[model samples]
Target chain A: MIIVAVLSIIFYLLSLYRGFLIYPGFLLQVAYMLIRGIQLERLPLVGPHDTLFFLSSSLVAFAIPFMFSINDERQFVGSVSVIASVFAIFSLLSRPHNIPLPPVLRTYWFELHVGLSFFSYALFGIAAVLGFLYIRNKDQETEILQYKAVLIGYCMFSLSMIFGGIWAYLAWGTYWLWTPKELWTTILWIFYSLYLHARLRKEWMGMPSVVLGIIGFAVTLFTYLGVSLLMKSSHTF
Target chain B: MLCPAYISVKINMFKKLLAFFFSLRTAIWLLLALLFMLLFGSLIMPARPEFSSLNSMPLFDWLGENKAGITWWLYGSILLLSLLTANTLLCSIESLIRKQQSKKWLLIISPQIIHIGFLFMLLAHLLSSTGSFRGNTVAYEGSALALPNNLAVAIKDITVELSPSGYVSDWAVNIEYLSDGKGIKEDYLKPNSPSFYKGLGIYLKDIRPYPVKTVLLEVSREPGAVWALIGGLLFMLGTVTLMILKIKKESSS
Candidate 1:
């Protein structure tokens, strides 16, 4: 796993100049996840290590589309590669252990819930990068792309929350739990919703909305990692 | 006949209030307020022991019984959400009425659909908060437990599979629904898989196999489950449609 992650990061860095090497890098990450999943006999999304690996893979997956669509491909892809590499490094730092899936996490709904949530996080990650580029370069196109990324991410996150609610209801008989993790999830969702609404106004279009995009991703990361690590909740890994 | 000065002023104030509730700005501000309150509650919940009782019962029941400084954030959030709900309804109504003649029907109607879905979700939570029932019971094999509505559940069997490492590989509980001292239905419950009878659901929370063959089962009745599912579906549908439409429009332009 360490060798695969290091190779993937190297390919991602090489893709900054070559741009085509991203495909191989993304493939390597996916292969690693597939191998882990086959070995574990379940989706490899139970702990921080696997989840971070999944997030890094998703970041590459989402960044692939922009490589062809955007004009500032090098910068955008480079930013994504850097962020994804950091997460990959983080995953490497955390020791991996093979454990059977707990009874509570054996449901298809839970798998879908976790999968979609990480994918949405990846989208938000891309949006934050775009927002940063826009702030640096004052590019109007980057701003527009940021909005589009956020719109898509918001939809996916909403679906993820819905699946989570359904899973919770099935396992615990309540759709929503009053836990710190759940509360932060709602806060993150509403923060993005506020961003969406702020984008509708003319004055908030350029910098304000872009800043929200960046801040929203920070909130997303905190919700995904900080809540589970710092606070006591059912989401503790 | 001319209206009195005070009456005219009062009518103008009422109109201002209506306009405020129907504006997008109000929606944004209310969402921001709710977000802040939720953030505060998230912090306070971990630091305060009083807030731990939040999940012990329905939300309204908790609110009615516990009045403490720690819960002020929740109270404030509920108020903001109520106001936000009103704003959502009025804004959707205003939009539909104003855009009634627009040629882009999907574009015009998509946001309203989302609003309706949000309202339905809020209603689902409200219903569950006020009327939901949750109870936990431990039952051994062949033991019968009584439920609401004169329904009884009999534990028929329990299965626990242990792996080589002595970890629980799989587990399930077989149960029969009895009414009037007769079995009506038989089903099995596993983790994340609950059995539903009428409107009530039975979930196998845990199992103890060695000392005694007993299982911890949780019975709950949520009146809002279906509504929440419907609302979630509609919300997804509207957002997807609106996103597609926007993307197409942007690309074309």
Candidate 2:
């Protein structure tokens, strides 16, 4: 796993010089990692370690189609590759362990809930990177790309929350809880809803939207890790 | 009759108020206000740990008492969210009314549908606040506990599985929901498999297998659950439809 992640980072760096190697390099790395995960009998999303690994893979997956379809996506791909590599390293650092799946989590809803949530988080991460770049470079194309990422992220996050609510009802007898993790996630959703509302106005479209995008990503990151680290909650990392 | 000048001034003020509620600026500012309040609320909860315990307390009672800063911040967030909800509803209605003139039905209706879903979810939570029931109870094997509406719940058996190392591995509580002194349904209440009877959900929160063969169960009845589920579906459908349309438009460009 570390080798694949390290090779991905190397290829991303090499792509900066060659500009053509990123496509095949990222694809091969993700394929190998995915094949390994398949051999493990479950999706790579049981704990923090596997979740981050899956996150990195999903980020690359989001970038792949855009890399081929859009002519202006090379720089975006480079930026995302750097960010995805960071997630890979973080996954390795978090002490990767094969979490024994409890009988409770052995359900389709559990996988769906975790997978969709992590996938949307990766999309929002990409959007945040483009948002920062848009602010610095003031590029219209990057702004459009950022908007698309946020739009897709918004959709996936909504679905994840729905699945999560249903999962809670099935597991804990209530659809909503006042737990710190649940509250923070709800706040994160509200932040993105605010971002989407801001997108409606012509005046707020350029820099303000990008800034909000960055802010939204910050909230997402906090909901993902800060809740577990800093606060007490029922969620097990 | 009324004074013409005074009537005109009143009309102007009302128009400005309506415009303010429907304007994107109002929506943006209201959202920002709600976010600020929520951030403050979340921060203060950790500072005053008792805030979590007081979740089931009524808002009016909390306000009537002299409390910590977190209480005000949390209530203030609820107020701001209410204002935002009203703003969203008004804006969606106004936009739909305007779009009617252009005859762009799909484009006009998609967002309004999402806004309606948002309102439905809020309504669900609001209605739930009135009659929602949550409680923790301990029931031993072969013992029955009577609940609201004369529904009785009894623990039939407790099964505990131990690992090779003699540690507890997994546990389950077999429970039966009864009505009129007869068992209607029997189900296993495991960690993830909670049983729902009528409108109530019964979960096995904890098990005591060492000294006493008893289980701690948390049961809750949420009348608004169905509404929230429907609202979630509508919200997702609206957003997905709009996203697909936007993607198609962008790709064509």
Candidate 3:
């Protein structure tokens, strides 16, 4: 897996120089990892490493479509490839040595819940990158792309929260427990909501909306990493 | 018989207030205020175990007593969220009234549906805050638990499955809902699946193998759960519809 990540990084960099589509390397790597997880007889959400690996794969998977849809998506593709490679490296470094899936986690709801949530995180992360690049370059196209990405991510995030509530009710007998992770998730949702609302106003259309997108991703990072590492909650995985 | 000047003054003031409440700027500011309050609550309160209970408890109950300095922020957040809710509702209504004559009514109306859904969820939380009941009970084989409204829950059996490594593979507990000492329904409660009885949700929280083969059951009834569920579905429906319309418009343009 580590070798495959390195190969993906190499091909992604080559794409920048060669101006050719070389994302198949990343796709192959993700496919291998997923097949490995399936062979292990569990979803790819068992631990921190598995979760990060899934995020890396999902980010690359979602970002690939943009490359085909837009003419100037090479830079975006390369950036996502770099970010995905980093996630892959982190997953390799932090992976545990053969831990079995716990009984509590052996449910379809758990898989659906985490899978949807993390994939949405991937989309938001891409939007955040676009936001940052737009700030630096002052490009109208990047700004529009950022908005679209955030909008789709917001919808996915909403679904993830709904699925999470259902999973919570089934497992813990309540729709919400106000855990730190859950609270932060709500905050993240609200942050983007503010961005979308601000988009309706002419004064906030240019720089301020992009700033919100970048800050929203920072919140997303904290929710995914900080909450899991720092807090004592049922979602600590 | 009313003075024209007085009527005009009152009408102008009402319009100003309506515009203020329905303004996007107001919604953004209120949302930011609510966000800041929630950030404060989640970041500061969880560090201290004593005040951590504030997270799970209602804001009104928390404000009834002092818990360091977090209580004020919590109260402020609750007030801000209430204001935000009112803003959302007013904006939705205002948009509905204005867009009644537009051709793209569905495109405009879907977002209002989403706003109404959010308010419904707020209502659900409000109702649950005052009416919900949650408690834990230990159930053994043949043990009975008396409940409200002349209802009861009786434990029928317990089953535990262990892997070759002696780790617990799975566990289930059979429960029978009794009304007037008559069995009305039976269910097997597992980890991710809870049993429902007369609006009460029964969850098998834990299992004890060596200690009398007992099960820890958590029973709760959220009177507002149905409302919340409907709100969630509506929210999803409205969001998807809006997105589809937005995409179509973008493509056409």
lDDT per residue as tens, model 1, B30-121 = 99889989999998899978777777578889888876577899889889999999998888888899999999999999988888888899
TM-score of 1: 0.97
Model 2 regions more than 4 Å off: A23-40, A69-73, B1-6, B54-68, B101-104, B162-172, B208-213
User: Which candidate's TM-score is highest?
Assistant: 1
For candidate 1 chain A, which ten residues in a row score worst on lDDT?
A63-72
Ranking by DockQ: 1, 3, 2
DockQ of each: 0.82, 0.57, 0.65
Overall lDDT per candidate, in order of appearance: 0.88, 0.78, 0.79
> Between candidates 1 and 2, which one is better according to DockQ?
1
Cα-lDDT of candidate 3: 0.79
Chain A vs. native, model 2, TM-score: 0.90
Q: What is the CA-based DockQ of model 2?
A: 0.57
Q: TM-scores of all models?
A: 0.97, 0.90, 0.92
Ranking by lDDT: 1, 3, 2
Q: Taking the tens digit of each residue's C-alpha lDDT, what string does model 3 give over A1-237?
A: 456655765675566655454566666667657666777777667677777877887887777766665445666766776787787778778864355665667887777788888888998988887887787778887787788778888888887887777777788777777667877888898998899889889999979899888888889989999988998766786
lDDT of 1 by residue, A83-199 (tens): 888898888888676878777888889988999999999999999999999988898878888888898899899989999999998888888888999999999889988998889
**Clash pairs of candidate 1?**
none
